[model samples]
Target: MHESLPISVFIIARDEADRIARAIDSVSDFADEVIVVDSGSRDDTIAVAESRGATVFRNDWAGYGPQKRFAEDACRNDWLFNLDADEAATPELVAEIRKLFAAGPPGTASFWQVRIKDVFAHESGPAPWAYGYNQIRLYDRRVGRFSESPVHDTVRPPAGARLGQLSAPMAHRSIRSIAFHVEKMNRYSTMQADDMASRGRRLARHRLLTEFPLAFLKAYLVRRYALYGWWGLVISTNFAYTRFLRLAKTYERELAARARSDSGAA
Candidate 1:
């Protein structure tokens, strides 16, 4: 067997039995250790992770950032890579990472942003010009760590920390189906709404009217979802709906709060 890199790959999961193995397998060959922090999964998530040679720990369901923070602390190595249970590192990405570590520690770069491309349910992989976003997935814990916000699970590198970008992209197999996407969006929107409410954010009435169409245009055109043809339309529509739903739900919370204030005054 080849020597593993001194990197700890951590994943925060819940009921991801069917897909967690792929995430683990993708990094198992190169990473020194794989840490799976499961959040009360009823499925065989823990069993599957353990069978695949992952060190599994059960944490209760916290929000995204906190969950990732928990995983970050649990990692043994200073160099860490965070992969979701539904995502996998492509061979090119793996090779690139391996190359980075070949000649001792990476110079100057404390964190590396990786492009995470979406792989639709029917597709085997991402298209040549797939729409994707970059995130700091690989980093040294001393220089960077996952944010604590419940809704935002991004890595926050210290000021002036040198950041590098990986050319190869990771595959995100997040969408199971249209129904599944909708359900996922619904849950996400609720969390987003709650987060906004906690932060005292209020949406204007005009946002309810313009949110869907504006979001649709942004996703379909600016984000290049149009490249996927009809599938792109479906994806864009879902994306738009998710955005609008969050705003609507947040507005609903505002209205409810106002009603509560009025009742208490009476």
Candidate 2:
């Protein structure tokens, strides 16, 4: 018989004192265990988590995946729910999770896809709330760990692990300001460049013209970012530009290094 699981809610944060409280409040009702792993935050983030009765642990700054993986591993429960400090669990979702646990532990359900209510800076149309943007938030800790991608870290559920969906929606309130976007791009782009370099990919120049434009069109126009009007357009454009900048900057650095090597060899 599968043993009943103790559901632990974990969040990895850095300099998120302003938003961490909201995230914690959202899940406070349903979560049996709330764990917050902070990565060298310069703000009162640690204090906020501690105030909420959450188990707070402070560590040096690491990449997203590694930080989350560390937090997950620190959890003392069998079942884990990974939440960002900017994301909140809706009351409806909380109730659903409670019911799920009440019916004994989830044995076959190793992973679950929960809907994400992606709130934008300006609510233009319907707020993009629907049956899409699902993420594997709740999962069995034993299934698989989070990928150590410095940029976009993700949990890789184990093979043959049953995946389910929850009716409740997880509200994402992080991607609001332009400042956040810029800083995130700077950090993630650098990480991505390092990732590509590790793979030994050759430098390519044409990527500048090709990748940037396409990224802008795909994210802004094709993805209906126009629906949100100017702000959305700006956000989408920046999103695309960030990706381009990552590749372009990395390629340029590699090329310069190669030329220096060639000159030295001659």
Candidate 3:
């Protein structure tokens, strides 16, 4: 067996019994402890995580950032790795992380970013030219913690903190199926809209006309989703629609506020 590192890997899950195992298994061999924070999953998520030897904690749903913060505090180690229930660390990524700690704790780097690529249900793995985004997944909790935004769940590294990047990629199984993807997007868009409205954000009326097309072009052309052909088209279209939906919902909230103001004046 490979020597385990003094790293605590945490995963927050909700009704993800089917995919959470992969996330836990990927880190099981090398991590000192695996922590799974379950937010009241109706399915067997807690049971499955326990079966895989992950210490499970029950927390009420409080948005992404808060949930992750809870998991960070629950970790026993100063070094923490955050993995989504739908994502798995590739063998290459696991090796890279091990190498970082081979001599001792990573030198001056307080956090490391990993490229996370989408693995569609139809595809066996990420394409050679798959589009991915970088996120800070491994970090010293003392130097950084996840932001508390309800809609944005990203780590906020302190100013001047040293950062490093890992070339290896993490596999993100974000899309279960076309139908499931749509449902998930709808829910996310609602949350995004509510967050925006609470922050007093307003959208120009003209944005309703241009948001979808602009978003589609960025996803399809700039993000290289076009490389996936028909699957790319479907993904891009859905991505555009989600963006448009958020703007529309935000605009609706603005209009309702205006109507209330006018009624009060009358």
Model 1 per-residue lDDT at 146: 91
Q: Residue 152 CA error for candidate 1 (Å)?
A: 0.7
**Tens-digit lDDT track for model 2 on 8-79?**
899999899998998888887777778999888999999999898789988776778888888888899878
- Which stretches of candidate 1 lie above 4 Å from their native place? none
Return the lDDT, model 1, position 163: 96
TM per prediction: 0.97, 0.89, 0.98
Off by over 4 Å in 3: none
Candidate 2 overall lDDT versus native: 0.80
Model 3: weakest 10-residue lDDT segment is 196-205
For each candidate in the order shown, give its overall lDDT on alpha carbons: 0.92, 0.80, 0.93
- Compared with the true structure, what per-residue lDDT tens digits does model 3 show for residues 1-266? 69999899999999999999999999987899999999999999999999999999999999999999999999999999999999999999999999999987898698999999989887777898888999999999988899998789999999989999999999999999989989999999999999988887778889999999999999999989999998899999999999999998888888898999999999
Q: Residue 45's C-alpha lDDT in candidate 2?
A: 94
